[model samples]
Target chain A: MIENRPLLNLISHLTLCLGVLVVAFPIWIAFVASTHAPEALNSGTVPLWPGDRFLLNYAMALGLETGQKTLNVNLISMLGNSLVMALGITIGKLLISMLAAYAIVFFRFRFRMLSFWLIFITLMLPVEVRIMPTFEVVADLGMLNSYSGLILPLIASATATFLFRQFFLTVPHELIEAARMDGAGPIRFFIDILLPLSRTNLAALFVIMFIYGWNQYLWPLLITTDEHYYTVVMSIQRMLSVGDAEVAWHLVMPSTLMAMLPPVLVVILMQRLFIKGLVETEK
Target chain B: MMSNLSLANIGKTYPNGHQAIHSLNLDVEPGELIVLVGPSGCGKSSLLRMIAGLETITDGELHIGEQQVNRLEPAQRDIAMVFQNYALYPHMSVFDNMAYGLRNRRTPKAQIRQQVESTAEMLQLEQLLERKPRQLSGGQRQRVAMGRAIVRQPKVFLFDEPLSNLDAKLRGQMRIEIKRLQRRLNTTTVYVTHDQTEAMTLADRLVVMNAGRAEQIGSPLDVYHRPQTPFVAGFIGSSSMNFITGRLDHHQLQLGELRIPLKQKVDFNGEVIVGLRPEHLHRGTDYPHRIELDVSLLEQLGADTLVHGKVPGLDQELIVRLKGAAPCEPGTRLSLGFHCDELHLFCANSQQRIN
Candidate 1:
């Protein structure tokens, strides 16, 4: 911006285009494969162009009765499960983390710092590291095939809580004092002032957390054994496992595209707020 | 309705055992504006906060309207505060900001609307009622803050250096606006500021604080003319009061080789400090007490000229404020006269005014 350099701009644009193509190449391949029949992709090297079976493949993937039957679950039900799990995780995490951060930052109770640090320590332990014990706890609690089993364990992470705590600390102390002088109690202050001020952070975190919940492969695969509890993301694996024969690449590709659709749509729709939230929260 | 507020031997010591405010006692009459003026860390703000119930009193009792409010919360204390930063809710509109208190108190919706509209009209913030705080200028934000406090209709108003954040011109304008508003409302108010000019202009009674203690409390002119302690004398006036150490002998004060007769006889005569205000020192040779000073620096402010110099044979520098411009170059000698009654005498050790 400071100096107009044509060659530098050219190089930058070229690099960006290359990065975009590299990222978009796989999705394009998936789309092409989904449009073709199983016989077209069974030969050496997958087809890179669409065939006449575009409507047939998507309809079979979405319909109750289809050409390939690896799993008994329908595409609509799997999509519904994914949507529910993502919404549950996003809302649950936001609720619990905001309350925890509020209590830790505003209240003067004993062991407040200890509690904050205990929550902060959870950042070091990802779900992948504690999957076995978490799954066992879910099974013991009989929440294995429910939405709570898919959402609650993932909501226990400290990232959102820490972000909220950092944000709450940056809010001017004078605002809190003024609210107190205005006859607003703690609940009123949180509802009237704190929540509205945190709108951008909430939106940004929603985008991240929704994608996190939607793209969960290992957790959903390990927890849900029932066909009705299958998320679109985990159902892709079930379609791939065709037992002692060639896999149904066409069906698997369409389901993969379906699994990736909602989160991609969310990111695209809230791109402005997502970018603003990300930048502001880092401050 | 207005109510008298009193602090009886109030004090604050932090948990770490650092005492920020000494036992401070003051009786604020109803509808009076008391300005607490001091340097930073002098506990003026702490005293204001304690009176507002934002800070706990570690020592004594606070009474508002004949009720002991030591254990009450800030909201229950019936006091509204205008903070230095304005503290306007960035997310709320100006109307919402002003109406927040009444809403919290569960006032009827119709009443809240009427009160907010009236207060906003008073502050001239009606046009900005729908705009957020961030959309307003510094002066507008300040008015919104005042509107927020005014809508509450509390018994007392607390201001913690509210004008410290504005620019010089806006501060002057807002100072007059605040004084006028307070006069119209007639609410018992406690305002805090480190700037003495603001304290002098806005306060009905000024409390000059130093080192966590009130050095003097009186009307602005009374404190300026008759300061009780050396700290009060030095802090109240601009450009500072010059003090000269000399020996008091019988009825005469001996300044090295210069001898000046005292109009009144004093009992104690060993060592004393003579205080002289800059404005009191006139550029003439006719007055009873005259001294020749070797001019060191001259600052020409359009309305008045500040002469910084030293008395002959004295190492201490003395400043004289002369009306209009006096184009006297440095290293020249000038004879200045001051009245005998204008001299302030303090004990050399205790720094307490003697005569």
Candidate 2:
């Protein structure tokens, strides 16, 4: 499709190289800040060079007494919380959404279209507004301060459902037909043909949903009152405000950097797979 | 060994009440390539789907070798299909794609690998086994699709316009390849295509379809030479058979004041269409089909020349095939002629063949 384009040819290699650096600036800042000492951060005399406080920051964030909750801000517990939330959401949502998408895209049902539209319209309603009612529902379920309370309400994701539905829609209806002719029933056909064909798309969605599940702040904060239920994002916010005289500059920087690492690494690693998956969809 | 496929009064009424296929009937003998050829809206694909059990037989029975498969699922039909887009799983390597069905059936790994490798070798896809579909060319992908089907070793093979996605040159190449493969396997193959050339060269018998119904079923040559219906005549040939409104009077077909020799004699012939193939026309004849035609255009395709010209009182210009290149200019006058036996007469009102 790009064969006839002479316009792209006119763009020079140097300009393209410059564009790469522009995108890398934020990532560079995260790493640079991560390697520095808390004193440099506290002095507000931003260092142009890497400092030797990497160990100091780590020590402060992980320490039990003054360094622990002051700078580190119980981030280890928060990291554990985020892991539970992300994994629970990713695995649970993928299964339920896939089943929903398969039925909507491939099978005959009385209210298939209506079900699709209901799910699709959920893509619009901001979760911010639904926090109160959703919190009430989670509380009514008696899941307060529990991991279920953290993961359950948002576990049934419309985004993953929508993405999987789109991917399933593109699967050549022939493959499903072929699977049907092969004497395979609905579940067998989905597992054998549709799932195998959809690996790339699924991987792409897994990355997207994993990041979203990991980074959720507002809902987790609103639902769980227990500090034990604090997710990684909430831990970062807590660390930034942990002190009276001076914020634990020591633990705050490293803990914040650590909190952001998983999602950043996820994006970096899965970006190639995501791009390849997108192109495959066009094919 | 081959399998018989029969569709008995199969009709598909979609949920929205669109009858995509209605009361379609077809029977296939073992080991024959049955080609379903038709226009876009025709339900050729639907009929094939019904036979394969990919689609439910809405109001009838579908039998594969005496088994009433109306309720049988697609996998139970014991048939494999080659899709139009080749539907080779995009992310899988060619070998994995071909081996998938056998693996699903729990054929041992060694046997599955051997079958897939052998099928790949046959399709000349050995080198392409490790490659993903995106890496392979269109023709290679098509071969991989065929390999996937062949590896199943099913009772029948269903092809839904398998070569439609390739370029003309590759399509011609793949058509020959597919026909040769089908001949070797002698599977009871049902190929659905709208391309007349594919239908002509590949089908042992052609099922010409229109609007969810079969129009005619016969050998490619039989459908071409003795078209039972006017649609078959117009569809089977390129430079589609010209339909000129004329009166079949005794012997000759009188179009306006011009007359062409038509050997058919009918009792009642008030209004009819004279179906003349482009190749059937001639440059010389004694009892000539002489018409004063203006050369609208000429397409010289190396071996033969297509003379596009208009006759007097006709709203549309017609095309005539000339053997070898003809040095004809636009707006020039030319005389065209043909024998009386070449004329195909059809009722102008009913659109059915007269002779």
Candidate 3:
């Protein structure tokens, strides 16, 4: 970037293009295969360009067409399920973590640091580590196969709590004293001052938690036996394994491409806020 | 409308058993400005915070108007404070920052707007009302802080070293502006600061505090002219007062290799710590007692030059203030004299002023 030599520029651009190709070529292949007819994909030579049956393949993949009765998995409802679970987990995690951080930081109580450390200790016990016990708890509560089961198990985030706690600690104590002098009660101060001040952090965390919720395959795969509750990520795995039958590359590719959309949209929408939250501490 | 503020036997002891303020008492009339001035850890700020209701008064009562506010929350105490950092809400616009209190109190919308706009006008912050605190300069932020406090019209205004964060010129400007605003409003205000100049200029009554106690409290001039304690004498002046241990016998005060005839006889004096202001020492033996000093360093302040030097036998350096660009060089001996009555004598053990 500093030196504007022709050779250096060409070399850097070539390296960047190669890196892009390394990351994007597989997604490009998936898009091309999703557009082609099933016969063209079964011919063994992968198509480099998109085909003419793009709409038909996508329509069948979305469960709108009556062409294939055997693979009649409705992707639209799965999309809705993913959206709900994502939103639920994002909002729930943000609310619970922000309140926990607020209590840990601003209020004085018994076992304060003990509570914080208890939450902090859960960072080591992720969903995978405590999956069996968590699943048992969810099953006992009769929450399995429900939206609450998918979202609630993943809602309490120790990282977000720790992040918010550190952010709140950086906030000047004078602001709280000033708010108190201004007759703002604790709830009012939290709503008006603390919430707005933490906007970027919230946005950044929303994008992350939403993506995490959207891509959840293991938990949903374990809990949901009903096709009605299956998320897009869970359906992708179900689409690939059909006992002895051949994999439908056309349907699977389009569904895979569709599954990537919501998370991508979220990132694009909150890119500015996410970058700002990570880079700068806005006062 | 303003109300008088009084603190009776106010004290603060932390839960960890460290006492910050000990049995402090003051009564500020409705329009008076009392400045508590001291160094860091002197408990001046703790006393101010106790009055503001930010910190609890461990032992005594605080009254704003007729109500004893020991149990009242800061909001219920009906006082506003301007902090050293200005403590403006960074996210809120200047207008919102000033209007937040009134809004929280649920004043009518139109009345809130009127109050905020008028307060902004008084602080000359009308144009910058839409700007956030980060967008404004330090002086503007300070004015916004002041405007926020003024808009509330609290019974007592508390300023916790409000102008200390500004640069020298801005601090001076804000200092005058604060004085003007306080005079116009005539609100009882308790201000805490470590700067002696601010204390001397801003206070109707100055409280010089040291080691968790109010060493002296009086008019600035009264405290300056007649400091009852050695700590007050040392802390009140621009340049610290110099102290020298000397002997006082009968009507004669004897320093090392120098003797000055006393103007008035004291009843009892064995060993006395003599206090002298730098400006009190004049050059060339014009009045009475003369002392020959060896020059060590010269600090040339424009209007007055302070010559720091040492006498032949005294352990401490003596500074003499000479008027207007005195062509004095460092390492040059100068003869200086002071009047007999200019001497301040304190008991060496108790450090209490004797004469």
Candidate 4:
């Protein structure tokens, strides 16, 4: 990269193109296949280009038009449920983590580090490991098949809390003292000073937690049996498990592409703040 | 309005059992500026924080005006502090930063704006009011920090090394600005700095601290002329006051073979540490006693020169500050003369000044 020789540039550009193809080829194949008729896909030769039924396949996938043996479950409502659960989880995680990190970093109390470590150790006990107990608790609270049930169990993230704690630690002690001199009490300091200072961090965490929430599969699948509560990811499983019937490749491909859009948009929208949050050196 | 501030037996001991400040006391009349000057870990900053109510007083009473503020929160103490790093709220605009305390106190909206604008104008930060702290230069940020403190009109203005973060030129400028602001406001101020020049130039009454104790408290000139402890004598001047072990037999102070006849009578005399200010020594036969110095090093500071060398009988290096450059080089012998009254004598063991 330091040398600007034409041959070197050509070679590097060719290698980059190859890398892109390696990563993007599968997505391209899915997009192309989603536009084709189900009949076109069953022929065993994959289509590499656009087909005539682009609108037809997408319409069926969105539950706007019904095809033969189409998915009886509503795709639009499933997408809505996914959005709600994703938003809820992202917001829930950010709020809980920010407060926990604030308490851990700013206040001095007995067993403070012990409580932080207790939260940190939960990183190892993700929802998969504590599935039964989490499910029992959700049921006991009568929250099964609800947005709270989908979000609450998965919202307490140690990584995000640790990140905020590290950021808060880097904030100079003079700032806290200055705020105290300005007559700002604890909650006032947190809101006026700490919150605005953490704008980029909040944006970055929102994107990450949003994607994390949107892609949740096992947790939703385990808890949500009601079709009204079905997330797009869990519904995809139901789509594929139509009792030994040949899976709807055309419908599934379009829905898969749709499922990836919200997270991609989130990343794109918050790309600037995300990078700033991750790499900022200034307070 | 100005209010007198007093500290009675102020002390601080960390929970880890490290005693940072021993029993210390000071009083400041209304509109007076008191400076706490000491080296690091001398508990100067800790003492200031205690006054501002940012740090809890371990065992003492602090009074601002008529109120005992020992257990009060910083907000309730009615004091403002300008930190070493200027500690302006990085996220808030300069105007908002200045107005924050006023707003917090539930001051009327129009009044807060008026106070902030006037403070900004006084600090010459009117144009920079909409800018954030990071957007401004170091001096501007420093002015904004001062502006923040001024807007509050607190009982006492506590500055914790406010100029230590600036470049030399900017620091000098801000030092003057801070003194002027404090004077115009006529508030009782407690300023802390390790810089001897800042302490000497700005303090109305200087407290020279050592090992968490107030070694001396007086006007800058009074402390300079009459240092009660060896630490104050050593700490006040630009270069330290040179100390040479000598014997005091009656009126004759002896450094090996050289005898300096004392003009005043002394009651206690024996092994004594003689302190000499470099500026008080001259390089000619103008005074009562003359000592020949073998020059070792020369520091030419343009305005003045420091001649570091050793006298024939004294084993320790003798530093003499001369106007402009000295004509002597290394290994050359220079004749230096000093007045008898210029000699500062202390007990060798106790390190207390011998009056």
Top DockQ hit = 3
Fnat per candidate: 0.86, 0.45, 0.81, 0.86
Worst 10 residues of 3 chain B by lDDT: B283-292
Q: What tens digits encode model 1's per-residue C-alpha lDDT throughout A74-135?
A: 88899999999999999899999999999999999999999999999989998999988998
Worst 10 residues of 2 chain B by lDDT: B260-269
> How many Å off is the CA of A7 in candidate 2?
21
Q: Per-residue lDDT of B1-355 in model 3, one digit per residue for the tens?
A: 6799988988999999999988988889998999999999999998988888888889988889999999999989889999999889989999999999999999999999999999988999999989999999999999999889999899989999998888999989988999999999999998999999999999999999998999999999999988988899999997889889999888678898888778787865689999999889887647777888798888888999888999899999987888989656778888888887888889888888888
DockQ of 3: 0.86
Q: What is the TM-score of chain A alone in each candidate?
A: 0.94, 0.85, 0.95, 0.94
Q: In model 4, which runs have C-alpha deviations exceeding 4 angstroms?
A: A1-12, A66-69
TM-score of chain A of 2: 0.85
The residue ranges of model 1 lying beyond 4 angstroms of the native Cα positions read A64-72, A281-283
Clashing pairs in 3: none
**TM-score of every prediction relative to native:** 0.97, 0.84, 0.97, 0.98
C-alpha DockQ of every model: 0.67, 0.40, 0.86, 0.84
Tens-digit per-residue lDDT, B272-307, candidate 1:
888899999987677897888899999999999999
Better of 1 and 3 by lDDT: 3
Cα lDDT of model 4 by residue, B1-355, tens digit: 8899999999999999999899998889999999999999898999998998888899888899999999999989889988989888888899899999898899999999989988888888889989988899988988888889989988889999999889999888888888888899999999999999999999999999999999999999999988988889999997899988889988888998898778898877799988889998896666888888899999999889999998876789988999886677888988888888988889988988886
Question: What C-alpha lDDT does candidate 2 achieve relative to the native structure?
Answer: 0.81
